[model samples]
Target: MHAALNAAQRTLVREIATLGTESGVGLYIVGGFVRDLLLGGAVREVDLVVEGDAIGFTQTVFSRLGGRVTPHRRFGTAKWRLPRELATACGWTVLDFVMARSESYARPAALPVVKRAAIRDDLLRRDFTINTLAICLDAERAGVTLDFCGGAADLQQRLINVLHPRSFEDDPTRMLRAVRFAERLGCELAPATLQLIEPARAHVAALSGDRLRHELQLVFEEKHSANVLTRLNGFSLLAAIHPALANTADAWLADKLIAAEAAGAAAEVCWLLWLYRLPAAESRLVAQRLRLPVRLTAALQQAQQLGAQRNLGRKLASSEIVSVLAGVQDWALAALVIAAQDEQVRTNLQRYRNDLRYIKPLVTGHVLRARGLAAGPQYAKVLARLRDAWLDGEIHDAAGELALLDRLLLQR
Candidate 1:
């Protein structure tokens, strides 16, 4: 773990350790950083906990380290953002510092009321045992592991266990988190922990949309997202988020997602594919629940419309293809192209994506004005004709386009 630190990070960590030691404050690295390091997974986030005033600790750190510290006094937490030069050198910017604290929820899915407490109490409030593991960062004890819970045992046993039964009750969002950790860590939820899920299922509805959407985004960013999603569905957590998501056959969407990603489609296209199994109205409802960006919502709708069209064929001229697909967002067309089952349909969509969609008239409104055509709807007609001729291979060169334009003008 010490070797995992880059030179700059090593310097920063050592400085923090020295400062903590001099101040006689207990300091440790907590949460996912310790968990992943112990699991031999690559660690990125650095979460530190202090058994003292975390904001005061930050001021001390800032004086010694010459960096900015953002202290949230209400939460007994601070963010120590490194000086830019050091941050640039290390490729890591901010370190989270928190006072050891305990929490109690007033109601299901309510934000916790936090109180400063001992490290053990702080560990007790964590969602999972594995995440409760901490590593001492004092100068004399820089590598000591602290386990107030049997987190190490659970890690060795490859199990995901809640610290207490009410964990999911307090925050049903952990139900989704449980699936993520289990799938990501290659662990199974302890059977007793699994038993606690059903009763708290309804509380999943009480979670804020941002929290649920953030968790779903993490799932999609996972290397084995499909597996995580399938596991989530098995728990009926998907139904808790939205009935539309639950009704969209898990296996079908999973298969399409796998195929779409295999084609190297962009994330936007992949998202539409996730919404592909739903009816237009249900898709919008799911999008609304997830708070998908306006662009993605629009693309999903356009992709649905494309699904209903049967006229696109390989035999369609490039001009015909553009006419049919015109004004459809490029991302929507890409999703349509990826979803198409027929080779001919895929080919036609691919041509537009790769080549034909970029075809444009050599003659512009400016050129038309110079040619003595009045500035009115006639300009649009002439440009469209020129563009179509180019798209249909009727005008292969700039000279051919101009000649065609001149002849069209004479005919007009």
Candidate 2:
């Protein structure tokens, strides 16, 4: 276990143990950090649970570590953003401290009501067995493994077992997380846990849009995100969130997601591609249902509009092609490229991506003004003509641009 940690992590663990000893509080490294450490996966984030004041513990740690500490009073959680120098030296940034607490759901799919509790109770309240594992960081018991729920056994068996049958009922988001974790870790859901998923599908809609969107974003972040989507589709969980997803878009989502990642596009681009075939109103509905950020919704709308142009045929002039794709983001354009089934559309998109998208006019507004062109609508017209000429390969240099500009002015 000690060999799993690098020098920095071991140092941080010792520091935390010392602090726990001084404060007379039980401290342990819990959840993903311990699970990943046991799995020999890269442990990037540190999740600490404390039997005493989490916020006060983090403040004291920050005083010695020289990091900025942010506290959430409501949840008794605090996060420390390691100082730049330390982060540079250690290759870690943030550390989270949470009060060891038990949680209960008031109703199906509602947020958990938390209360301070013992480490055993806290571990029992977690979503999955593997995540319930922890390592004690007290001075006397430092490095001791706590596996009350048989988390290490489940981890060894490569299974995802919910701590309780109502785990998904309490948080339907856990269903999505189960798919994510299964796909991410190459594990399977325990049979009992898998049996509960279908019944829990009914409670999915009770979740907030923000929570749904957040889990979906994590899905996209996975390397085999398509597998997660396929798993969701199989369980009818995607339909539970929004029928449109299953009815209209699920067929192509997995394929487009794979292609989008292959093309090095952002997750939002994959989302836009997923919903690209929906009509304007349905697109708006999906955006609202997911509570998508304004920028992404606008990009989706723009991609849909650009896709509707239908004028990007092979015979179109370079200037017309450039005009069609002028302001579209690379990721959005990549979405369009993947979504386009027509050979002509794909060809045109490649043209814009490879050649015409980078075409810029050599003559700027300042240069045009210096050349006695007034700053008015004609300035735009003249510049557009120059840019068109440039895109068409008719102008190659400043002199060529000037010559084209002179010709346009003469024609005008």
Candidate 2, residues 1-412, lDDT tens digits: the string is: 6777778767877887898889889999899989999999887577899998999989999887788999998889999898898787667788889999989889999888999999999999998999999989887787899999998999899999998889999999999999899988889999999999989899998989999999999888779788888888888888899887774435577678888889888888878877888889978987898999988888898888878876775567889888888888776778888988788888888899998887889778898788777789998888888888887878789888888787877776
C-alpha lDDT of candidate 1 relative to the true structure: 0.85
lDDT of 1 by residue, 332-363 (tens): 88777767778888888888888887889877
Angstrom error of the Cα, residue 293, model 1: value is 2.4
Relative to the true structure, candidate 1 reaches a TM of 0.85
User: For model 2, what is the alpha-carbon lDDT of residue 307?
Assistant: 85
TM-score of each: 0.85, 0.93
Candidate 2 wrongly placed segments (more than 4 Å) = 247-251, 406-412
Query: What count of clashes does model 2 give?
Result: 0
